[model samples]
Target chain A: MKIAMPDGSRKEMTVSVARIDEILKELNINPVEVVVAKNGKIVPEEETASCADELKIVRIVHGG
Target chain B: MLNDLEKKRYSRQIRLFGEDGQAKLKKAGAFIAGAGGLGSVISIYMAAAGFGKIRIVDCDSVELSNLNRQVLHWSDDVGRSKARSAKDTLEGINPEIEVEALEETISKENIDQLLSGCSLIMDAMDNFSTRYILNKAALQKKIPLFHGAICGYQGQATTVIPGKTACLRCTFPRAPPVTTFPALGSTCGVIGSIQVTEAVKYVLGFGGLLENRLMLWDGLSCSMDEVACMRNPGCQDCSALIGDANYKQEMSK
Candidate 1:
């Protein structure tokens, strides 16, 4: 599967995990700190990511 | 019915939304959660746009270091309370509207009383803990929250319509580590303007709100991007409210 990070970089990774949260954990990214979208639609934390061709993870935080 | 002075004051915007829209704006109350960088911009715009009543809360005193981004406070106001400075500046911009500035820290205790009668809540807070408090309040009141935050040249904004769209906790389950962050005034202007725009649209009942979308702004690249978002069924803040009549009806479909 291909994953796109917030910095506009893509990484190819092979994982046998079915859930998106597990994939994020394998990539050393905290699932609770970022929003994950499969293809174009946002998926819930427990949703399956094994069938997705493209994945995007965006960190949601700011200073104000 | 707009008086002659108000009609002339908001002529340009009235042309966009008409008398009815202007009236709607005049009848709504907006709660601003801060009086700092983002709050400065949000309150300024909300006041100028005629948001009838505005209640802004802050506990900090102005300092020389805050002059770079907190536009509402001037160098002479270095020792003054931020809420007082903000009230003076907002009233100076638009005397026709009512500005109620409170010099108190926003916490779970007074959150409900502070937000009473407010039609909308604008998130201009500096920390996530306070933002979470405002979010939970908005959810309980079934009021919309226009959220904006800025750090240096980057900023992000989103709108939360309670159970109708993704709540703040749904999008950000964990708060980022708190630290003193570098900030630029222009970044606050960008995100804050978008938030005020969302509030105006929501009050006027027109245009597409930023529902289920998180807008990210990068000033360095001069690029803007939006990421999709959705409600989390197990969200700690808003999950229980999902069983409300309105949410249940929408979910049933």
Candidate 2:
């Protein structure tokens, strides 16, 4: 499946996991201070563990 | 139907804006929330500019401390409800227009009813909770919201157009943790004038509204910046709207 990123890049990945952390780790990302948007919608923090989709990640914290 | 006196009274602005612009102003209905510092200036300008209908909402009564900034209220108006005072002052400026004074707090339950049928909503509120509620209502109703906030010598203004542009939440997912910030009366004047500018421009169909851009002014440094921004697809409010639409389509069972 093609996973979309916030920067509008597509990555080919085959993963059977629904959690955001799983996808992040698979993509070599640490899940701290990172916000995930799946298919252009914000995945609430509570649902991040259960929601499944082709994902786009947006990092929220750093420099203002 | 404007008369000769009305035309002459507003001749200067009319000459610059022309008859069509004057007509647009006369037809617009503006809902101003919070008749405090910012609302004071915003109400005056909108009234002076000849917006046909304006609703001023506020729950507080004018106090002695409000004299420094709230120019709309006189010493005689003290101890009177701010909304009523604002209405009185606005009408005094132009007796031809209609002004409604709603002396009540804009709670979550009543926001929609208060804002319904208005062309635009201007938020001059001091608290974040109320502003958030306004933002949600604006998005849900698809009304253009002009937001202005001030602290000390600094102020920020932005325009949010439902699904078309980034919202206040997109910029700050959560309200800033700080409450009880300092604010100068002049800062309110500066920011509130910009809010009025945006509202008039929107009403008159003038060139490019300040969508997706945060206009910041710092009286301390005398600097201004237009921070360009875009819609955050990840914004909960934006995303929820998208979800509900898709959900409705799929669940047509």
Candidate 3:
């Protein structure tokens, strides 16, 4: 299986039931502030682990 | 003489922004919540600047104490509803503009009705509960909301542009438990002016708003600073409006 990471890059991997956060740690990318958008819609924080396939992650930053 | 009237009526500002900015002022509509302290200054400026429509909502009557910062009322105007006095004063300043005052408080139930047709909502309210309610309503309706709070010589202003900016909840998830605080008249004036400036900028589609920046003022120090903030993806109020059911369940009453 191929997983889409937050930076719009894809990584080929074996099938595993891992959350996006776990996948991020595996890639050594620890985003401090972020929201998950899977297939173009916002995924609730509570539902982040449930999201699967072709997901996009959005990061929020403190801006002035 | 028509140009003369424009030049004389807005002579100071015309020299600063020119006629295009003045025309923008003539077509704006603003909803101001709380007709006391800060509201008085905001409404007066909006009306004087020729905003086409001004809506003011406040349920309280003027007391002698309010005379300090609420300059729109006179000794005779005491005992009258703040909203009513505000309407009369604002209309007197610019009768060509439409000023509507509702002797009602804005709650979760009635906020939408009060804000209908208004391009921006100004939270001149003193209490946190009402401000929070107005904040949620404004974000849900996708209306720009300018928030101002004053305590003594300290006050802050922030412009929340729905999906485009960090909302009130993103900065302060819960209201400060204190309901009453000592405030100086200059405090309200400083903060209210900033709020109205942001409101006008939002209405005129001007350069850019103070989005994502909490502008804090300290009159005692004569200093101002802009602190950066971001949308707390877990903020109970805005997160729910953005479609987070879990946060909604946690905050739902």
Among these predicted structures, which one has the highest TM-score? 1
Q: What is the per-residue lDDT of model 2 for residues B102-159, given as tens digits with 9 covering 90 to 100?
A: 9889999999889866888988888666888888888788788899887767777889
Alpha-carbon TM-score of each model against the true structure: 0.93, 0.75, 0.73
What DockQ do you compute for every candidate structure? 0.58, 0.04, 0.03
For B117-178, candidate 3 gives per-residue lDDT tens digits of: 88788888877678888888887787888988887777778898777666787766545545
Worst 10 residues of 3 chain B by lDDT: B244-253
- Point out where model 2 deviates above 4 Å: A1-64, B243-253
Q: Which ten residues in a row have the lowest lDDT in candidate 3 chain A?
A: A55-64
The order by descending DockQ is 1, 2, 3
Q: Write the per-residue lDDT of candidate 1 for residues B27-98, one digit (tens) a residue.
A: 999999999999999999999999999999999999999999989899999999999999999999999999
For candidate 2, what is the DockQ? Answer: 0.04
Better of 1 and 3 by TM-score: 1
Cα lDDT over the full model 1:
0.89
TM-score of 3: 0.73
Better of 1 and 2 by DockQ: 1
